[model samples]
Target: MSGIEDLLREDLRGKTPYGAPQLDVPVQLNTNENAFAIPEDVAAVVAEFVGRELRGLNRYPDRDAVALREDLAAYLGHGLTADHVWAANGSNEILQQLLQAFGGPGRTVLGFMPSYSMHPLLARGTATAFVDAGREDDYTLGPDFVRAAITEHDPDLVFLVSPNNPTGTALDREVVEAAYGAARGLVVIDEAYAEFARDPGSTALGLLEGRRRLVVTRTLSKAFAFAGARVGYLAADPELVEKLLLVRLPYHLSSITQAAARGALACAARLQSEVDELKHQRDRIVKNMRAKGLPVADSDANFVLVGGLRDAAAVWRAILDEGVLIRDVGLPGRLRITAGSEEETAALLDAFDTVLERRPALFDLQEQAK
Candidate 1:
């Protein structure tokens, strides 16, 4: 610990955001972002909208984020209005607001492991307790397990992720219903990959509308291909939405972001088609990898998890040199590959094959060690 940093928050010691890897690799497949570029029309709309605001840089943005909220609520199709929405730099910050509103010392936030890495980190930021719901070997949560955890910990916040990252599995509907029955806590389902899933329309809102304790988080980074834009949304009961709005910084969503998100929403047909294309490619990737004797997780989103690769980091390093990049899950012997355009996907698999074929000695070592 640096003795000179005495003014820092006591909890800040030895903690930092999850460090994403940076590589100069050619084909980047690491972050689960959409590889497609934003539609030309959508980009033009954002440019024109922000062009109007270029001279207003000195002025503060709408503190309430009124326009973006209204558009988002309507896009969600849940009888929402501006009062029923809130905007932040991304859903990540929106989560921070939820924690602030509902968390404090001794209060606990609960979630499963190998899910999003941010859940526990954010809970710690609130000075609240954190708990985990254990999953079976396959990463599926049973209704019994959920009920057991709720009965045991009784957390104040429960984070859920559908079509989870790194694993790419979706929670079964029955399991979701049972989860709602199990907890009195605020249940937050992160559907950041929802748009790329089979039925992106099945948001948790429809199941528990008017319930002030339930919240749904979505991001435009994936489907809209605007990850750099940092625009995401929250769908909750109007009362909860109002609370988040009150806590958020003013004009968190820039004019460009608003225009870009709205433009993408208007071109839903094109976006949906892109999502469909990604899904098809993802299926083929999973199938081919599985047939190659590589263990892959069943996925409903735009990515696939290929397991059984010994030394995920070593494999990742090799892929980088092969002119491809994939996410290092840090889980022993596991790697996550994002679904890109058909050509991109092919390039990734070719690179994967090259690495695995030349790597019999690594796999032999792993088996011996095990």
Candidate 2:
């Protein structure tokens, strides 16, 4: 008999699952998670909200997640109502549902490379062909560049990640409009890190007025310190939201999750109070790294991407040896680091200092070239 490996789909025969290293270290600057913990006041409210649902354990959750969707809509505040919003266990699920509804065998989904990484993986999971159009060498997307790529691929779905992961590059509004104008398919703007953006008003949410094909995905995980809760949502046209219901599992979101998310939404202000600080640290990282002769990407997210390493893997290992964990996003000479609390940030910088003192050749491109 053939083994399970032999029975696996040919496309998935050599693929790796999407994940970052989950290791115990003195400081973790990987994965781009909010470093701050949820405040006690917010936790108490979430606990009370979740407690109320314990008595209804036997009953399935609200299959529609109507109230949760309402709360998410209110939080988003783009003149969107519950009809225009949808919730899921996480943004990853939301993306998957979209792929299921709009992308499948023979359909294509196009995305810029070095993005959230999961965009293509989710496409593959749904049997959708993924196309990488790639970005400029500096990792910025222009309106013309976006339109050209969308026109060339003519994908069924287009993913544009603002304050994009692993690079922290935010998409300009014109670029989003350009992609939407050129594509005949659904346009997805993954704004998972929008709360950390330098200009809060630059959100594509404002452009949702007449565009039915546009979707903006958001998550409370980063700003609200709710990564563990796994709450994510999206804002789109009501018709599109309805289509997701067909592909979503019944009672997909648990009552506890809905209640907790609602409670958190109620306390959005308090929960997101640390966002400014995180942005401060993000800028600090870019400034500090650039000063050290490293090329750091300008970030509007809670993380910074540093390039110019002679050996990124070796630098990663050296930093890990100092008990600091950052991400080596498979870029040849680059690494991504999350903005942590002041103390954690200091630890990360110190770890880098120590590593550079001992292994300058690994981190200093000039030295390596010499």
Candidate 3:
């Protein structure tokens, strides 16, 4: 008899699930989660909201999630309304939904490589062809390059991640405009880290006026310290928002989740207060790492990507040995670290120092001869 694995989808049979190491370490700067705890007042409010739904657990939540979407729109404030927004479990699901609606079988979605790694995985799960258009050596997306790539691929969907993951490079408005103009299909901008961006006014939300094909996804995980709550949403043309309903499951957002998210949105200001501090720590990491002669990428996200490692894997292991955990994102000679609270940042810096003290040559760009 054949093994059960033989019955699995051929494409997913040997693929690895998307995840990072979740070791229980003294310091975890790997996942780019906001390190601060929710404020007591905010926590109390969220608890109250969630508690209110206990009596109504027997009834299904509003299939449309109207009130939560309204709260999200108010928080985003780009003249958006509930009709233009949709919520889901997380931004990953939001991306998956987009692929399900617009990208399945035979359709192609083009994304610049070294972006959110999940973009391609989501495409694969939806049975869509994923095309990687390489970015510049520095990982920056130029308008000319974007336009040319879209023209060549003629993809059905294009994913542009602003303040992109792993590298923390933010896309210029010209780049987004070029992509929108050159692509014949939908354009999805994953802005999960937009709250951590240096220029608050530079969001693609400003570009949504007449572009029905554009979608901007946001998450409360990074800036709002609500990672555990798993609330993510997207803003797009009302028509596009309606189309997602066709693919979305019934009562997708539970009453508890909806209430908790609404409660969090009520305290959006308080939760976002930690954003400035996180940005400060991110810049500090860039400045400090560069001062130590490592090539650190300029970051508009909560994490910084550091290069010039002689052996990224070895260095990662050494750091973890010191009770700190950062991410080795499969980039040769490069590693990524999240900006945590002050104490966690100190611990991370100290761990790096301890690792480097014993192996001063770790910063050497060239690999050792075999």
Candidate 4:
């Protein structure tokens, strides 16, 4: 019934892809997006920036993304200049670039399990082996585990996310430092959620002080509220930056994208207030959820992960019917709900309460287990 193109990859054939809801739903807590809208004033600036570049649309964008990179370096560096800064459509692309450059053809890409999911996906799509040495049930990464993996897997590239996705746990500096100790391969720290990390200064980007082989990837999508802008940057040593550039698509970042990204970067202070507001709300929801005996993960990112439910699908289905769309991690009862605005957060809580109540069998088991 199916054509040959459908079975082309052979390995990828019959694979069920992961996806979020496409149906129109209110209070979308599904995607880990900043629920707060970009402030009108900032939006105005971005609009102006785009307007300025309107005529240039006929021509190609800056292939090197020099202006945007300069702005990102300035914002992230707090004035220090680092030529290692690079950009792409989204930090996701930046990640793919790293994978393409370091991992391919008889090499392996290694990452801890239950991460952003793209690590292994990228490896698979590019004809590489994916090795997951992720944390077990408790969800903590031990330096010993990482060290053992390096010795065993000898991966060409290792991918890690701090404030790791789905589960918000962050690998502390010590663990990361240990990874950097090895001189063999590149370690990419996907800091896409770094905007909401516990302490901003403690970011891997700043930690790079002068280290080589540690590439820290960041995005404007989260804290900057620029998800539609598709802007993300990587901070690394100049040499590694050069290697990544070799494989980057020409004129990869559009001029409009560059202008908007640069404009947003210039307003970090303004964005921090929004981040603070979201964190406050997240803490409140988390505390209340845990107080009610729900097992929530220690998330270092913008969302909260509520695990240990009896049936994740039941909870997800119930909540969607209630007009709120929270993301299901497909891990059976693990939901990654974004920290929405105050009203949205309240609606989410109400939805959860309703869902848990309706799924009595599930919650009953939860209580009995507790």
Per-candidate clashes come to 1, 0, 0, 3
Off by over 4 Å in 4: 16-18, 78-82, 364-370
Rank ordering of all candidates by lDDT, starting from the highest? 3, 2, 4, 1
Tens-place lDDT digits, model 3, residues 1-370? 8887898889889888988899999999999999888989999999999999999999999999999999999999989999999999999889999999999999999999888999989999999999999888777889999999999999999999999998997888988899999999999999999999999876899999899999999998888888988889999999999999999999888999899999988998887778889999898888878767788878889999998898899999999999999999988889999999889888988888888799877777342211
Which parts of model 1 are misplaced by more than 4 Å? 55-58, 363-370
What is candidate 3's TM-score against the reference? 0.97
TM-score of each: 0.91, 0.97, 0.97, 0.93
Q: lDDT of each prediction vs. the true structure?
A: 0.77, 0.90, 0.91, 0.81
Best by lDDT: 3
The predicted structure with the larger lDDT, 3 or 4, is 3
- Residue 306 lDDT, candidate 4, scale 0-100: 81
- Per-residue accuracy of model 2 over 142-253 as CA lDDT, tens digit each: 9999999999889999999998987888888899999999999999999999999989987899999899999999998999888988988999999999999899998899
lDDT of 4 by residue, 66-160 (tens): 88878888887644454879889888788888878887779888888888877777787777788888776666777777778777878888888
lDDT of 1: 0.77
Residue 260, candidate 4: C-alpha displacement in angstroms: 1.1
Cα lDDT for residue 147, model 2?
96
